[model samples]
Target: MTAPDRFSFNQATAKYWPIPELVAGCVEAGVGQLGLWREETNAYGLDKTAELVRDAGLAVTSLCRGGFFNTPDWYDENRRAIDEAAVLGAPVLVLVSGGLPEGSRDLDAARAHVGEAIGALVPHARAAGVRLAIEPLHPMFCSDRCVVASLGQALDLAAPYPADVVGVVVDTYHLWWDDQVWAQIARAGREDRIACFQVADWITPLPEGVLLGRGLPGEGCVELRRFRDAVEAAGYTGPIEVEVFHAGLWARPGTEILARTLAGYLAHVD
Candidate 1:
């Protein structure tokens, strides 16, 4: 069997799985790459998690988010996140530029704040050898989840920093709706700003909080292969991290979830 080199199973796909068990499962199943969330990583113990993954001979593709700039403690939190990524040997620290701060509808101010916040973290990120990857959430999440709602927006915010220190995440679920996403991906490539690439299918009838609505690749309407082609064409040669989030999927066993995620990736992405 020809294994997928860049097929990384994001830990969130099996949201409730114990980190140690997940690591063991990945090793057993021949999955060499993974993406992780801070909360889970922290719960598993930062150094412990790093040691576990290292011992398993797995590669930590990217840490799932270091940014929430709108928060009061963003400075310290982000620096801590950078250190965490470095500790885990993860090269990328995903950034979810937080949405409009409490009761502040001024989108312009909020976006500007995000840029400045990232600028402040650039030095730390560079020093730690971690790239801050800005992820553009869907527009529906712009008001409360992320202000960077499009690839173009993400690219714009990352423009002021060195491409090595700041870059963008290419997620199909979020960028599929944008007609100009192709152009933006190309621009990101031209500028060497593609830090990471994530895969998730877009599904409808989102949950109440609208957080757990993603589907496995080929389970939704997204053009998964097309997005993959765009990212590859745009010069992104890193791991294609599969990061689907959904309540139903979370209810299953981690092993089963990993199997299904791999099947979907082979059918729809690779």
Candidate 2:
């Protein structure tokens, strides 16, 4: 069977796009899914933002974030994020396992901390009908941002949880460099652990200390069609949310970036 259609855009890309205008632009572009951010949601207020999306008839694929597990006092913060996801009817909460504590040498310890934190919040997430989507950042981000740095690793961390409560996001920019990505995708499919499938191209020689250099779909070196096919073969039919974090792209007009992004996705996906 042909893969079912599922495409989404994260509003965070439109950081420069005014909320009302962005919603209208997304609707006009025929983009059906969105990933909302906590700061933006709070700024617009949940009710107003939801009404805007509702008026545009958009489906919220996932909330931008809900975890920063390295924090010593992150529990309450995470709980509040869970509540917000439920309020917005977002099915998944993208988690970026936080960085190492100051003067700490133990990466493994930080990862363990992530496990403990997620374990603590799983019950609350389930209660709120929010699936925790563990996003394995690229290994380049291992030191400062995410300890979980591979799709396989994220899957291993989430294996014990019930499928509906936990799963993994397969982002092309993050996992495309892995030699074993296809194998991991099959494993995720076998276990039904794929929660979100996102995309952005990988750019090299990344600037110093800057974590966000994501390229537009066709601008960088990624095997887009192969990645999409593997994820589809693994039984994930969720929206393909394009999450580019480029400063250049972000500075451009929202409508132009979005229009180009949609065209690029269609060009590369098939």
Candidate 3:
């Protein structure tokens, strides 16, 4: 079956897929949308990757990241990320707020810093025509990766900015366990803060890193269709990016992975 109109394949799902091959495979599979990560694009030469995807008629739904507020150079780093998003025509730059600063256990302070950092970058992001999307990773990542661990907090952080300037991502992989997520999703819609929507299922026996433990759309227990319906009901009619990150999935051929992703998305999400 053909992918849904809103379906977007995040390149990370096929982590090992080279840019050229990934683009070719997407074209062959009739996939028209993609989500990109910085490392891969930077390695392939941003401009070259941009040109390749543009020429192939694939639209970039969002760029993987631009946040890590705990870092000393966050301001400059995020500005560069905004520039790159503009270069690639991605409307949104996903921000993964960094964990607590070394030796600091103040969660409140860390989250507060995330808001301030976004406020600082708003002007640049606005000038570049890119929206800053705050992504709240699972609380498990709180100490070392992302401290903003809930959609409620993400919305709170975005409350100070214009809805167009700052928004939040609704990723099932990280948010499915929250009972308040439904309410938060509605609030996000009413507030116009839902910038990007992604899907991945939660599986047991997480891998060593935990970062790569995500399962494809239906492989785990998430209510994929329910989340899809929630976002749609909340008035978000943007791309629905499948962003699973598992080593086993990545080991498959790019086209094969894309096919499986499409199947899972169709069966469980669309």
Candidate 4:
């Protein structure tokens, strides 16, 4: 089967696009899907942001994020995020399971915390008509950002939950280096756990302590075509969301970045 024809640009990459203008630009660019940020949605007012996206005929691919499972008050925060996602008509609420708590060296403990938190949020997310997309951050981010470091592990945590309420985000930048990624992707597809598929290239020697360093497609070492093929072969036919987090790219004009990103994706991805 042919891949879906929609591709989306994450607003986070266009850090400069004020809400309304970003919506307009997304529409103008023929982008059918969008990833909304809580801060931006709040800045524009949830209703207004949702209206803008709907008016522009854009589909809410997935919300920027929910879940910092390591925090003492993580449950409340994640529940609120689920509500916000519902307000925006976003079907999936991306979750970044937070880092270890202060004085905590047990990564396994942190992971258990994430699983419990997700288990609690499952019903709320289901009630809100939103699916929780567990984003397995790169191993590089294990210390300070997220404990979900592999698709396999994320799947393990999600196994007990209903598929309609919990799934996974296959961001190439994070999972590309994983030796078992292909198998996990296939499993996610088989289980219908592929909620979102994002693309970004991997760059090394990234700034210490920051897990946001990612490159535009074709600008780094990831085998985008192979990855795309694997995802597609697994029966996931969804928008390919471009989410580069490079400081330099963010500084450039949004249009330039969008154009380059689309071109790179087309040139380097299958």
Candidate 5:
């Protein structure tokens, strides 16, 4: 089956694919969009990478991150992230709210700080024409990665800002286990807070850290299509990005990964 028009290959899915080759692979495979990561872009020369994708006629669906409120340089770093998103012509900048501060177990304070941090960046994000998309990772990551674990909490953090400026990311891999997810998705649509939609399956016996343990579409247990339908039903008509992070998948050639991603997307997510 052919990939749907909205299918976008997130760079993290092929973690080691060189930027130029990844762009070329997407072009050859008929994929029109991509989700880029900051580290790769910065290493490749942000301007050069932007030029490469643009010249190749590819659109950047979103940029993988700008938030980590617990850091000392968060404000400045996020401002730069906004600038990078603008340069890449990416409308959304996904924000992974960093875990609690050192020696701090105050979940309330951490999440609260995230809200305030986003508030401070709104002006810059808006000026740069980038939407800050708050991403809620799984609960297992709460103390070390993202404190925001549920879509409801993400929406709450986004509620104080204009939907067009600050929104939330709906990543199936991080959210598939929540029973209230369906309702939260609808609420996100009604509030116009669904800025980005990502798809990935959940695998058992996750490797240590669970950061690189994600499975590709149709590889594990997530109801990929159910999520697609939920997001679409909530009025999200943007690109459907397949963003899996597995060591095994990343070891393959970029072209092969893209082919498999497309196949799985068509079979399970599209």
Candidate 6:
């Protein structure tokens, strides 16, 4: 089968690759799209990175984050994120709903707050013409990283808003273990709530914090192609972002990482 038309290499997969090299490497590897993070884009100066990607004739598929509603400055922060996404020509701004607030154990409240938080940002996001994509991190990250833990939950949070402004992210690495994901993908398709589709393999013997233990496609147990098929079946015709986050993978040279990423996608996902 041919590779997906919207294949994108998320920069987080090659965490330490310098911005210029990452851009050059993607171009050399025939990658036409990218998923960028706030930190990396900031480090490179958002405008400069925007210019670089534009000059390379690459599309900024999605920006990695604009959530964490539990924080004090979430509203302003997310507005800035939306504006930045607009400037970078990214259509979606992925939101990682943060975990419980400090010393708080109210999971229900945390989730509710996320919905309200996204609701508040909808106006700005719509004004900027940038969609806010809520990403459901693995439930393993429930306590510290993200509270929204399933595709269904993410879709629920997005249900109240206009489909163009709020949506959910379907990352295979995080939702692969959930049996209900197929149904949720169907629901997402029916509702037009799928904003981004990310891919990564699930590997075992996780690291100390368990934040960066991911594998390239075909290196682990998860069925990458199945997830790809499900997303497309869900009526998602947008970019397919490869977002593996392995420390070992990150240590490699940027070009090697890009080449391997392309090969992995071809072998396991295409």
lDDT of each: 0.92, 0.85, 0.95, 0.85, 0.94, 0.91
Give the candidate order by descending lDDT.
3, 5, 1, 6, 4, 2
Candidate 5 Cα outliers beyond 4 Å, as residue runs: none
Which 10-residue window of candidate 6 scores lowest in summed lDDT?
1-10
Worst 10 residues of 2 by lDDT: 1-10
Query: What's the TM for model 6?
Result: 0.97
The per-prediction tally of clashing pairs is 0, 0, 0, 0, 0, 0
Question: Per-residue error at 44 for model 2, in Å?
Answer: 1.8
Query: For model 1, what is the error of residue 111's alpha carbon versus the real structure, in angstroms, after optimal superposition?
Result: 0.4
Candidate 2 per-residue C-alpha lDDT over 1-270 given as tens digits, one digit per residue, 9 for 90 to 100: 112248788887777787788888877777777888988888989889888888788889999787778776689999998898888889999998877877897998888888778888899999999999999998978877889999888988898789889988999989999999999999999999999988888877664545677777888899999999998899987788888887878889998988878877888874
Clashes, model 1: 0
What is the overall TM-score of model 2 with all chains considered together? 0.95
For model 1, the superposed segments whose C-alpha errors exceed 4 Å read none
CA deviation > 4 Å runs, candidate 4? 1-4, 204-210
Per-residue accuracy of model 3 over 1-270 as CA lDDT, tens digit each: 677889999999999999999999998888999999999999999999999999999999999888988989999999999999999999999999999999999999999999999999999999999999999999999999999999999999999999999999999999999999999999999999999999999998888889999999889999999999999999999999999989988889998999999999988988
List model 1 lDDT by residue over 13-130, tens digit each.
Answer: 9999999999999988899999998999998899999999999999999997878898999999999999999999999999998889998999999999999999999999999999
Clashing pairs in 5: none
**Model 4 weakest 10-residue run by lDDT:** 1-10
What ordering of candidates by TM-score runs from best to worst?
A: 3, 5, 1, 6, 2, 4
lDDT of predicted model 1: 0.92
What are the TM-scores, per candidate, against the unseen true structure? 0.98, 0.95, 0.99, 0.95, 0.99, 0.97
Residues 152-270, model 5: lDDT tens digits: 99999999999999999999999999999999999999999999999999998898768988988888999989998899999999999999899989999999999999999888887
* 219: Cα error in model 3, Å: 0.5
Question: Local error of candidate 2 at 45, Å?
Answer: 1.5
Worst 10 residues of 5 by lDDT: 1-10
